[model samples]
Target: MDKSNHVEINGDRFVHRLKELTDAEKQCLESQNMRIIPKLKAAKLEKDAKRHWDIFYKRNETKFFRDRHWTTREFQELINFDPDERIFYLELGCGVGNMIFPLVEEGFSNFYFYACDFSPRAVEFVKRNKLYDDNRMKAFCADLTTDDLFDSVTENSVDLASLIFVLSAIDPTHWSHVATVAYKALKPGGMLLFRDYGRYDMAQLRFKAGHKISDNFYMRQDGTRSYYFTEEELLKLFMETGFEIIMNTYVQRRTVNFKEGIDVPRIFVQGKYRKPLEGKSISTCEG
Candidate 1:
């Protein structure tokens, strides 16, 4: 048996239970025709996403998402960690330590944090933070699609992973690869927490005419890419790759623009999935 196949789950020998899906379920997944958007075709979209970040950070920098303290609340609620339960946590696309800083301040210091982002500027922002230290938190600059996270973490060792508002930024076609990589890195029974723009989000609708890069995916004027996902699509993607969802909810957030005197309605999909124990298949009841 491959050493990587054996994972430690809550201090126990974790094993893989890759169950065969029912024919009906397999057909349902196949009918959806999910695919990776090729990089060559997605080049413009990627460029657009990068441009959006450049402008966004230039103007707002650390103040952007940091002001929205609700993220910390959401993360705490999702993980529900005990005070003394030490765990290994990884934040994929962790920009500027906004989430990490708050997690530390809340006295949740029973874990190691590995944070990575594709942008050097973003990593630099995290590194410069006075609150960040090398002992408890390690920040790296790498693209999740191609970079190796195991260089910073042991294989099959992470307990929880967070992909908050990150996946939608990448080309939808690459998401499966990301999922596979994440699955390989996490321990059996480990959890994956995600929150991202759902299909028809206010931001997606805000795209100007000709901003349609692909179906249900768009490019912001600032060079950032986004994909709005449906609940069915999200469920099938993860479950197909071997995860059992614990919670999946579509949250509607209405942002009142006091400055513009308009209301912006946004929809976000949030989910928590757990890796199944060895020889035990996960139930797809929620899907």
Candidate 2:
């Protein structure tokens, strides 16, 4: 006899189990885990990293993601722009103007946008978009993790920098360097807004043991890698890089999968960190 999937001890509709796992299920789960060839993993990760991203852009082009329509709505910091005042904005790992186009459409006219992506094709997509304007939005292609971003953008420049779902794509060790660039690139008192995968997120939990690149890093079959972060970890990263925290919060949403009789929880870490206005001068780093 099969047991019930839900319990009603308190007259509440609650799910007791995700599903029953058989021995076959366990075997299949194990098979789905990531398998790294220990000796070649590092080399493979290095060589294929850029290529995989290139291929991803080539495959999906501009259709991969929807414009982030909720940006201004979700975070009110982006609003209250004055038409006469000029606000310089920089976006790292900007993908197809998802954040840019939306903010522009919302009439943040005073803000000039500088968007860069490692993938040339992705940059091209941004430049070619219907919403793109040379006078307002500039698109460039460069590897931010190892590139001198100042060459493309001005030094001590932008009033705001955004890293939306971008950091997870990078190697964890390189984040300090990433922060350095954003720090030096921003005007004193400028803010960096961040959002990325959070620790124990469903996406992280779904990965099998073999796919675990490190404690919280993993690679997908598509050759893309992601790192899930804890609130503490993220705080430390930005704090060490000379940013003062404004707001750090985790957002959780539960989506019910009626077909599978399961509830999938998605967790994301969002933050606003600012550089001190009256402090030391920003240091420059070479690529």
Best TM-score among the predictions, by candidate number: 2
lDDT of 1 by residue, 86-132 (tens): 78888888987877787777666787888988776788888889888
Q: For each candidate, what TM-score against the reference? A: 0.78, 0.81
Off by over 4 Å in 2: 1-39, 254-263, 280-287
True-structure RMSD for candidate 2? 8.1
lDDT of 2 by residue, 107-162 (tens): 88888999999888888889888989999888987676875687888778888999
Residue 136 shift from truth in candidate 2, angstroms = 0.8
Q: Against the true structure, what is every candidate's RMSD?
A: 11.0, 8.1
How high is the CA lDDT of each candidate model? Answer: 0.71, 0.76
